[model samples]
Target: MKTYLPQIERRILVRPNQTFGILNYDMDNAYPQRMLELVAQSPTAKDCWNKRAKFIAGNGFEEQTLGKQVINSKGLTMAKLLKAIATDKALFSGFGIHVNYNANFKISSVNYVKFEDIRMGDTDSPETAGKFALYSDWGRKTWKNIMRNKITFLDSYNPDEQIIKEQVITAGGWKNYKGQLYYFNPEVDDYPLIEADSVWEDFETEAGIKIFNNREVTTGFLPSTMLFMQSRREEADNSTDIGSGINTPSQLEKDLGTFQGAKSAQKIIVIEYEDESAKPEFQPYAIQNNDKLFESTERSVEARIIKGFSVPKELINAEKASGLSNGSEKKEAIREFNDNTSPDRMELAEVLEELFSHYCSNINPTNNWKIIPVPANVADDVIGVKAGAAINQLLQSSVPTESKIATLMYAYGFKQAEAEAMCTP
Candidate 1:
């Protein structure tokens, strides 16, 4: 048996406006860069902000930790603290990783730092320039930097405070820190530390707009309208006019109060009019259509948010697809699981892999382990139905053996070459 590695063109520069023009084709001409700049300038989406924050904060870090229990330098457990950091990262656009070490110079604990607390300096300087700097205060107003993986405090520290209080300088990266402090940000090219834009930003804006519409529909500020009274009397009509129509503001108020009281008590009231000829009518206000539209729009927005998170709509109690039979609904659920839920779980798995790897390297140097997410299982009935249909099609169709073999191979998750080999007579 021989092992073969696929030949890949690893250095294919897909980005526009490369410095080496010889290797670059000016097709789009920096359009990608302009688009990125636009995205960076876009405002944070407030409508979906809380929902996204809660999702990331609560569920993102839940049940994701591996190996030994992680406790931060401040004695706070990573399981709880990571949720806060994740929430902040989703709300803001970035976060910081602080490395802590024990007395033996080995890693003890790692913690998360808020985006606002840490600052980067001399980002343009190369790795060899020795001028790159990272600063953080952690809210105690004592700023410090990491030197050679060890936290080094600045000279401006109060000597009295340092002596009186055991000043612990916890920086972004410790002197012995070897693993990466940043994750999920590959766009920070040529810079020591640059925060990447949040992935949920666009969705947030859309969701916010929908929410605003829903709020307006639900709590609309409708203006009060006056009921007009038409008189048939001539210019000399000074006769005491007591009619069914409300003649004054006081009378209108009294009538309204009486009506409200009766309605609240679930009672019926009959008013005797002095003048039977005078008519009382109301200016019509219809809200049934508007209410229905708002409800539909809100449902659509909720569906979009669920789709954006790549979760099953059923999980959120969203309306199921209309006009689908029971069997079709089951099939759709399986498809949703395979397409969205499984992929999202897999991405989280990769993040956990990196996280565990970083922790293991520091705490137990020899412990090299990785965690894999369990894939969502599709229902056996759905699988069997689809497989039976495919087999029936293959038997009845006039397609060649190679085509049938290729189709069967695809259904069974075999490679193209392997399928062709199996089909060869």
Candidate 2:
């Protein structure tokens, strides 16, 4: 069989600003790229993007922390580890895992490999089985590439440990090994190796442009006002023998220097002239008004960016959401969190289920075992309304108090004895 290699150059050529799958010039890149090169990057955009990514990632593990029940398999204990890997990939766009096994065929441990040191190869050729190379540095020096059906244990920190490390090469198939290493590239179609790109990159650029424009406005027009001076007489004359008069150039230079000095010191300027008929008037030029427009533009752009991430505006305390009450805002936030955030968590859970199915089967042979994300809680208002409606219906119906007490005991986790005692009263 012919060994197939992917078109590595094509993948490498994709820029950070371009869309994931398409091979065309990114119009979004033109402005943000220029802003990055010209202005100080907007830390606000960067911070918001980071916070949003982390928020999304954390929402995946709702009500559960590390050491909690994420995955319930005998040999494969990878619930917390999988969550961490998924979070890292969401933040950095890629993540890798190194699967370790003991002398027996069962899996032993699963460790997260740094994304910076792992390079994916031959991605276009799925038939040949893509390669994963782990290196100590970004330069690709002193690296080990794990080819198809082979596992290479890398110890870059200690030279002595490196000498003792064993490289397990399995030729039969991936199924022969107790565990295998895997690299997850979430944005591989959009961005390749040697480039940084994320969902927030465009937002960051838009923010950068706003910041730059504001800076320009402040520096150019905010500090000082333009001064306009008009004089009734153009020429000054003195009674000299041969048209010898006051040097207008020297006098004008002196006046300009005095004006500048007065302006800098914030002092009142008083001009005196020898000619009584030479009348002069001073007027301050009006500053241009674009502050409101700039503010509106910024808000619009920010709104679009927040929408792009499918995040609720209330979560970010957006100003445009002033009409919503605190209670309504809280309800909206919870609804968005449950409806939007849970799907991503479900997709991640599904991926982990497929990857760790082998060990999952060992744990529960009779039934299919899979990883499941804990569901997000519903809004308190909705829950309260439902409970109220149910209580109203029960009161209207002819259900016995004893039956209601028993139902309450079962539904609310109340002790049956206590419920019965309350009913007796």
Candidate 3:
């Protein structure tokens, strides 16, 4: 007999694909694809991912021209590209940007490439290999399909003018040349793990819980049962009698199915037997505990998913905390989250700065090229504080210096240091 042990198989395994001349992202070469499907299925994961992306992208670039400059013929602007890169980084911890060069060897335009569509070529050193494979469907194992036209090999992004000129000449012109891809891996890994990878199993579990609940509701929480019917002979119209046997199991199944589902609930079933001692038996399985099927698991999984994304629950759900101080709590959470992710924002800014400075000529590289952070509402901090009225009252009243400082620190949203400095002398 074959024995089975309950366990989950590891999902990540990097291996080289000799036939395709590339390295598989994971065992199946579809890690990003699998993660995308998981996020789509889990509501909490999807929400947390979106929150991270939004926070990472922020409002836009500090330079207004960056937002207005169209990077591609499709009218895609730099702002949109940054947002796309942010989304990819949020999910996969890496992103790809396709750079197109003009006839003069200057970069003409750049576009965002889906991270899942890219695979590193099989090489000892990917940075110097200068080769990458791009395909639309990696999950379908397109490498084995033998369709040479589907897999497009792109040259790695090289800012060297001489190198670009040589590529242009080799292709007979810029028109026939396939564009270069700038694959940015923020983390130092062969393929960077997704940001919420630690909670990926939880995502699947949460999705399973949802499916279980949906099934339970659809079936009206009915308990599964087994029905055993004894076979009996029946006389035929010609007075011929068949050997002891009930209707065929398949036939009985068809009859039983009619009484299944929520619509057939409380319906009665009748069975016939030749002997009273050989009557049919109906055995119901143990009843499910609907009160606590997965309540705790669902909450813990949701919390872990949000935590994995590093987003404050208050930011994800505005109605989570309700009170007079809820606004202040949310505002602080936003500030804290933005501060925590500043390094991530700076990394994206540096990548963009490097790309635009070295390749494009239209934009001024010397300018302050940085992503503008999401603006926090100052009003949120003063949720219950009547700032203007209170300030007027304080100014007009003859309050002591210590009391005034305390009021400023507590009600006017001033730091203790600032309040003490203002009260000094």
TM, every model: 0.39, 0.45, 0.75
Runs off by more than 4 Å, candidate 2:
1-83, 89-95, 114-118, 123-129, 134-167, 170-180, 185-206, 209-290, 318-320, 354-425
Instruction: Point out the higher-scoring one by lDDT: 1 or 3.
Output: 3
**Sequence-dependent TM-score of model 1:** 0.39
Candidate 2 all-Cα RMSD:
17.3
* Candidate order (TM-score): 3, 2, 1
Using lDDT, give the best candidate's number. Answer: 3
In the range 19-62, model 3's lDDT, one tens digit per residue, is: 78788889888899899999999999999888888989998988
Against the reference, the lDDT scores of all candidates come to 0.41, 0.45, 0.79
Q: Show model 3 residue runs off by greater than 4 Å.
A: 1-11, 124-128, 141-146, 232-281, 287-293, 358-366, 378-425
- On residues 1-425, what C-alpha lDDT tens digit does candidate 2 reach at each position? 89987855332243321112212113332322232332225444444444444544553332233324334333334445655665555444456666544444333455666655553333354321234444443331334432322323332211122222332343333334433456556564443321123334455656666765766654443334554444434433312336554444536545545545323444445666666555354456665555677677667766665555455666665323322133466566755654555555555555545444433234333333233332234233454456556645654566798787766566544477755664563
- Model 2 worst lDDT window (10 residues): 16-25
Question: Could you tell me the TM-score of candidate 2?
Answer: 0.45
